[model samples]
Target: MSSAHYDCTLSLTDFCSKETERVCKLICLITSTGTEMLSPTGFVVLSVALGFIMTFGFVNNFVVLLLFCKFKTLRTPVNMLLLNISISDMLVCVFGTTLSFASSIKGRWLLGRIGCSWYGFVNSCFGIVSLISLVILSYDRYSTLTVCNNNRWPDYRKPLVAVCCSWVYSLIWTVPPLLGWSSYDLEGAGTSCSVSWKVRTAQSHAYIICLFIFCLVHYAASDICM
Candidate 1:
């Protein structure tokens, strides 16, 4: 009822409000840092799916590699290209996909910054390898069907060169991100790492755009040729 008493009461209320606000902000920061973005169900489902894929891929690719090694006749250029693709796929399972499965199951990145960078680098490298392999496969098939109608197979040297080039190209593309041309960082629930396409810088955006175009064109070419 008195002016001094009313003023004191107002100060007390303001203090309580500020304290409450600070507490809420602290709670928010803790949650943001500590909790995963994905729900438990989603995390489990993703983990299971990745596990299945890695298992299936590892088994099949391993078997195929063994078969190629065992059978001399299966070691042709085309088959060798297939083997390279299989090897890349198997590496993806080992280095990239399995780690993803583990992290997804745990619902967080157990790997630190260096691990994240390596994961992104390996995944990107193998992914590019697989794409380039597919493109090479399609080209080989196209040449066989269209040009090699006389039933003569191309020399091993030709496909060998192509395979070598694919590796070089994959390295070329994946290295730029690590070298600061674009960038690699964790993404999607903090469980996986990849090119930081979310970064809005000019170089990063350009790299992302170029990568999208590169992938789209490679896949489209492979699909169309096949």
Candidate 2:
């Protein structure tokens, strides 16, 4: 090749390299300053909303638990499922909602990467547990009604088994993301994290589809059928 052509090629490559580096830096700056995505008023509104949820959820669930503990009659099999739902929701308020509330007040995720993962996993676990518990509770109530109509006593052992199964079923769905079936990342104005639903890979898509079908669709169908 001619010297002029060789020199021109080197200059072009250098220019492209510099441009790429500059672009990378710009991208990093934008990502690192994610808190700016929301306005001050937006943060305040989010904080107030989350604060109300945290306060009311904790208080109401705690009241239910207190009543459960204080009274012997509330310990029936059907109410046992209610107790499970309350426990999951109360824990979600404690382990999940509190962190989101704090981050909303600060206008950013304070826990960093590991904390984000923890937040996502814990919330998903408890949330799914509550959902499955509700489904079981519905079925239990329906069964109770049928049994009452037939003048038969409901089996006590089934509700206990159902409660255990709900937790196990929740773990089955929520734990796969931690193991790389998908991931947990900051979502929605960078204030919180959950399942990486926006990911476009086959693995992520499969996980989301399965979760939707098994958890969400199942919940909906159960409620409708009941």
Candidate 3:
């Protein structure tokens, strides 16, 4: 059999497995897929709820993008970075809302491997870029405060560079998990391929320390600017 990121493993406990699947099936029944026992009432409630989520995401993201684009003065480096970040988040909503709402109602991933791969890939790319943008936003603030800011002529090129580099870095970290370089596990509803180093034991302590050291440099720089 081919290796896959997701597999049907017997749940860690018998009761847990039964209860979880039971709940899932019940949810499906109440919404779109399974036999709806309560007739049209359950169907209506589910549709309304799903619609609310999709609508909210769509409207909110659109407003953010519109406001950012409409106002030119908010085009400062940091604001510009934020504008792109919002665009990424909005893409998360736009590309996904309808399909996600459908899946939630129907209780299955209709998006097959092609869809999953693209969803997984794009989300990973955007998530990292958003986070890195946040981190860089802080750094940019520090740079401005420290009087070492990149010129305000707004090279415009640098932000694009950062965005491109952010996507590249995100892909580098994300692709490996699906490719089976490491064990990927789900912590909750969202898929997380993030490999975090913990300092629980001697072997893992070194990696944790290195992470802290790097963070320390950034923190110290921020303080100096402050």
Candidate 4:
């Protein structure tokens, strides 16, 4: 069997920093809130899992970011869009997955309902940003070959415009989840949470379908790129 990347024995909650240890003695350090729903064993398991995922994920995104930054040859508009995607993915690894996991322990959200909304909102935003960034990237490449193309993105301005649009699109995808159109469930262990897949209003299904179609298009586009 493969060894886990983290010392799951310690867990993210029990792992200390001077910050939280100061305010709430019962709470562990470096967490978003004071919720402890996981058994030591459950937390160990989760921490081990998240640690491994983030370890691999963070490294790859960081490497991708470095490659984009370091290689002057890769400084195209598409690469710029991809760099935004990589950074968003990195933020999800760094903030979304980890903080949500830490705060979900003990079942109830310790971050209050507003915090919960923001958490879901931010995670969804990053997710959509990653997808939209890729979509924009594909278009940037395809535009170069189109016969009617009057101007191709030749500077930071165009890439910046694309990046802004990516964020706008991502915000559209994310805001509904926060408005209670999508649900958040404290899955089994308190320290874990997800958008409630079981419950759905009309918009929820539409959102899911929209995401599915977007994903399928990207998958096809990526295959073509390959």
Q: Write the per-residue lDDT of candidate 4 for residues 105-177, one digit (tens) a residue.
A: 4334467665666666667788878877776677677766674655654567888998998788777766666
Error of 1 at 74 (Å): 0.6
Candidate with maximal lDDT: 2
Model 1 poorest 10 in a row by lDDT: 1-10
Best by TM-score: 2
Q: In order, what lDDT does every prediction score?
A: 0.80, 0.84, 0.55, 0.66
Residue pairs in candidate 4 whose N, alpha carbon or C atoms collide under 3 angstroms: 37-105, 37-106, 104-190, 104-191, 105-190, 105-191, 106-190, 107-190
TM-score of each: 0.81, 0.82, 0.56, 0.61
**Candidate 3 weakest lDDT stretch, 10 residues:** 185-194
Kindly report which residue stretches of model 1 are placed more than 4 angstroms away from their true locations once superposed: 1-36, 149-154, 222-226
> Considering lDDT, where higher is better, how would the candidates rank from best to worst?
2, 1, 4, 3
How well does candidate 3 score on lDDT at residue 141? Answer: 76
Query: What is the number of backbone collisions in each predicted candidate, taken in the order shown?
Result: 0, 0, 0, 8
**Rank order by TM-score, top first?**
2, 1, 4, 3
Candidate 1 similarity to native, TM-score: 0.81
**What lDDT does candidate 4 reach at residue 138?**
72
Model 4 regions lying over 4 Å from their true place: 1-43, 66-71, 101-112, 143-157, 187-190, 200-226
